[model samples]
Target: MQEPIRQSYEAAKELYAQHGIDVDQVLRELEKLKISVHCWQGDDVRGFLFQDQALTGGISVTGNYPGAARTPNELRSDLEKAFSLIPGKHKVNLHAIYADTEEKPELDELEPRHFQRWVDWARERGLGLDFNPTCFSHEMSKDGLTLSHPDPAVRRFWIDHCKASRRIGAYFGEQLGQTCVTNVWVPDGYKDTPADRMAPRKRLKASLDEVFAEKLDPSHHLDAVESKLFGLGSEAYTVGSHEFYMGYAIQNHKMICLDAGHFHPTEVISNKLSSLALYTSGILLHVSRPMRWDSDHVVVMDDELLDIGRELVRSRLLDTTHIGLDFFDASINRVAAWVIGTRNTIKALLRAMLEPVEALKKAELDGDFTTRLALTEEFKSYPFGAVWDYYCDKSGVPVRENWLAEVKTYEQNVLLKRGSRASIVN
Candidate 1:
């Protein structure tokens, strides 16, 4: 540590101790902290080592084949790989039960089929399956807004998605003896300026209002209302910040689903996001660095990395169950993104949570951005050049092609296992 940082550490230590914080205990949680990733369909389960006890396997649409028609054997084998590779106790984000299967004409009573598969998958694993609505799709949301959309067709599609999902979620809860964790991440905003901002936001409010007032089935579901900003690549809108509630989603529609990466282009901090939804008492956070506009560089070279992370975790503003990894890999090796991003998030969370809570208290009480900057500088006295060099170094990942083979074997076992030895739970 540099001379200045060593002094800050001393001060931070004393302040933290004053608040009855135990550094060692907090550090242990950090070490055990595993990140959450989804199980995409094309992924190889054996490529990554997932020994960490706290990591979660997110069942994301991008990761899993939610839209495909699979035999029970195929589904079971795919899930078995997920179970074998990912830590069992971790969570899975259900993007939805039935993906965009409208194009497939051979299907009938679609809801029952997917629900049956989902229930079977859940029963064998004894795992909790969480659902996140596939919002902002081209079909159901031509103009967007589950609650606020002017078009009746768009709004009705959302209702069907919710109603069908709730029924399935309830079934899973009863069959698996686990509640469905539902998150509404449906996109409902504009690409350009609208005549009224609240107009679009109000739609979210209405749907949330419906969830809050009716259509809640505990046997099948638990609610966490998720929202996010429109990408700049898309068109711009006034209520598009994703941080501001607009109207319906928070007060009327559903509970809060806060994703920190959702705020990067806006440059909002973690504390601000937590504060907004902290009152809802239903904050489900999606944690990740959004590397947009070159601002969300997820390196630890500066306080921008730890500044907000420390603030949020230290304040206990977030429940551990509410956090998940939301990182994106512009690179080829996806697992590396989960590893490095989780490592950074865990490290920051520990330093902030385990250290003296008052470490930043003095800086804030001092009430000067410059002083806070200096203190952060002292805390992070690592050589700048070294940090940059390390980030620039692309870690190598060995490529594999056996994921399809494994999927095929799993398909035969789960769907067509006449002579195969694969067990349902195995």
Candidate 2:
């Protein structure tokens, strides 16, 4: 396998050299780009703190796949298995609800001490950490309104949670020596037509003002706000619409998160990157797959994913853009979901980096649309899979579908045992 990989890589290198695409340099750049793998996927968004509570606020996990991580250790172990199959070191994204603490603490009362275990794990593995405030699934959010809730106390509780989340995020950065992005996303909206929308927007604006009032150091922590078009219940009105957050983030000098599935089906975040880059200091991307809507399906190497990669590479937004995966699929092996989604994401970015961007730009500048389109289409069928295989082999990870064998072996030995234990307990 090594010999075949080396031979294919050499041939592919020569082919890419003819088109002015350096495959070696592209791999190096890809190594520098880290994708923050979300932790919720391992347990289907059922965080540690609120396991007894029903998942609410327009969020639902459809499948009951075996071997869902039931403890922090189990989740970390699953992550370790998934990471072994992946090629590079990456960060883990966590929500406030996933805190590990013996004492029951409210979301507003969360602290850095609660997440020290996660910090230790990340530090040991040479990985970074990112955070988010859980603004749903609690009693306060039972009515589907949080930051913009009419009750001042309800809004205050969420505001405090966000504030505490920032401190924890800053703590992660300080401990790990890597900047942590703390993103805020609230599931606050109405299912039916609202008679008064301005009031909620005004309240939300004021609440956010309080959340961002205490400015933290930029070196250790960066703040970002994510907006959604609509959710299962919030189909009629979403308090934090795209335009609202766009204006707020630009005004507040905060990074804006552009979720791939948070807009109209026809709309793509690739096209919005250039526009947002001009205003926002930095951008946080939540890359996910949407089946007609925001389904949070495991990401695939599809056309839109490729387009996103191309835009990021061509626009030179790698330095300012933070890429993170946001999807949970319980229908398949949980660990396999992480491996598949993450590998496809890296492959998409790798394919984009392997493109001859200068040639395409030159063709476009010279008004040669035909050459531009022709080269774009021609590059699609290049020996991308061969280069990807070589990268996997070089990184000491399994090449191609060979990783699946290890996952299957793990399922039989580790995952199946978990299911049997659960059945006996039940």
164 Cα displacement, candidate 2 (Å) = 0.2
TM-score of each: 0.60, 0.98
The model with the greatest TM-score is 2
Q: Please, what are the lDDT tens digits per residue for candidate 2 over residues 1-426? A: 589899999999999999988899889988888999999999889888878788887888888778888778888999999999999989999999899878799999999999999999999999999999999889999579999999999999999999999999999999999999999999999999999999999999999999999989899999999999999899999999999999999999999999999999999999999999988899999999988889999999999899899999999998999999999998999899999999999999999999999999999999999999999999989999999999999998999999999999999888877853244324
Q: CA lDDT of each candidate? A: 0.47, 0.93
State model 2's lDDT.
Answer: 0.93
Instruction: Tell how far residue 156 is off in model 1, in angstroms.
Output: 0.8
In the range 116-215, model 1's lDDT, one tens digit per residue, is 6556665666565665544443344454445456776666666666656565556556666656566666555566776777666666556555544556
For model 1, the stretches where C-alpha displacement exceeds 4 angstroms are 1-24, 27-36, 40-89, 97-127, 143-147, 169-180, 196-199, 211-220, 232-234, 238-250, 264-266, 293-305, 358-426
Candidate 2 collision pairs: none
The residue-level lDDT of candidate 1 at 325 comes to 49
